[model samples]
Target: MTLLEVEGLRVKIRTEGGEVTIVDGVDYAVEPGQVFGVAGESGSGKTISVLALLRLLPRGATTSGRALYGGRDLLRLSGRALRRVRGRELAMVFQDPLTSLHPMMTIGRQLSEHVRIHEGLSRRAALARASELLAEVRIPDPKRALEAFPHQFSGGMRQRVAIAGALATRPKLLIADEPTTALDVTVQAGILRLLDRLRRESGLSVILITHDLGVMSSIADHVSVFYAGRIVESGPPPELLSAPRHPYTRALLDALPHPEAEGRGELQAIRGLPPSPRNRPPGCAFHPRCAYATEASLEQVPLLRPVGERRLLACHVDPFAPGP
Candidate 1:
């Protein structure tokens, strides 16, 4: 079943000078037990898009879009309605646990608080449930861990606790925003595996947001590559990663380090920096950095065109067209 759907999502932030668009015309869907990956560089609006879904944008930011979850429009929900849906129906695992978790509150109290609010369970019952959740996330000796504070746990354990809290309500959709950014490779793999197992066992839908193509390739069923404020290309993992069509997507994949080519020479990185939101390119946002950019690409914007069964490319030149 389709657990969450977002279409024509546009987000704008108000600055001293004027309003600037950060996310433009983005679209995607997530079904039960599916993992959808949103990949892009730092300023590609990946995190902003997820924040917009929960109505968690800054004071000066405004969002317009249709975010349908369980037959309800999230964008239209207000006050109490949105609150009820946030931690119960759709939960989020933020990038950093230290900043996300309450430093002063004990881990046990933090976990129990959500259960009490969302489930309305008694303090005793909530504590029991909290311990169970901690165990579920593989935190050793849940009893002792609960008594400790955020600083007491290692980076990985703290992240696991954050994940545990997100799953406390057994939300239908989980949005993990760069959940593994601060962890090492081994810990990152463990966390990914744990999330994958939880999704399969509980049939929860997930949106994994990150800039690492390797991480997405391992977990996501469908991948969307974002540039500036728009989706440049989207398709199944094998197709998008192996045979990317858009110049920006190709450049991103080429930038990935290959062990085989390491000894030959230095790696080739994409030239130029990403365009600023305050001053985006006129036509294709990536034209300034794209190697295959032509006059046509610089003169007109390209819409996402159907390329394959489940593939779409937003580029002026059709890379798969008949040869010259």
Candidate 2:
């Protein structure tokens, strides 16, 4: 079943200069037990798009879209109704666990309260569940760990705790926004493995948002490459990373260090900065940094249409076309 379907998601926030569109007409769907990845550079609206779906955007931000989940439009849900869905049916783990977890509160208190509110469990029951959750996420001595504050744990362990909290309600859909950010490579791999295991075991759907295409290739079944605010290319990670049709996706892949290029030279870097939301280019936002850009790319906005099996691309020129 389609877990969540978002169509024409547009986010506009009032700035001193004027209202600027952050996410423009974004569309995607998440299937049950599938890992849908959203990848892009910083300030590309990947975070803001999901934030809008959860109604967690900053003040003065307005969203227009249809985020259908369980036959209801999440964007149009009442505050009370949305609250019930937020941490129960849908939960999220933020990039930084330290900021997400309370500094003063013990892990036990936080986890217990999270489940208590959503599941209506008694204090004793909630605490026990909290310990079980910690253990489920592979935290050693879960009971003792729960008594310690967020600061007491290492960066990786703290992230595990955050993931535990997000899973406390047994949400069907989990949104992890840069869950492995700031962690060591080993820790990052561990977190990704954990997520994959949980999804496989529980049939949980996930929306994994990050700028790291390498990470996306690791666990994401499907990846949507975001530029500025729109999805430029989307396909299965294996295919998308191997033969990207979009110039932006190709540039991103080029920026990553490859084993084949070991000791070859420095990695390729995408030129120029992402356009500011206030003054995005008329056609494609990535045209400024794209090496394969042409006059058509600068003058016309290409729609995201299917080009091959399970692949969608938004581009003017065919990267695989023969030279003139």
TM-score of each: 0.97, 0.97
Residue 292 in candidate 1 has what lDDT? Answer: 79
Candidate 1 per-residue C-alpha lDDT over 30-104 given as tens digits, one digit per residue, 9 for 90 to 100: 888999999999999999999999999999998998999888999889999999999998999999877889999
lDDT by residue (1-324, candidate 2, tens digit) is: 899999999999999999999999999999999999999999899999999888999999999989999999999987779999998999999999769899999999999996888778999999999999999999999989978999999999999999999999999999999999878999999999999999999999999999999899999999999998999999999989998889889889888988875697889888888899999998878888887888988998889999888999999886753356
Model 1 TM-score, 2 decimals: 0.97
Candidate number achieving the greatest lDDT relative to the actual structure: 2
In candidate 2 the C-alpha lDDT for residue 66 amounts to 92
Off by over 4 Å in 1: 260-265, 320-324
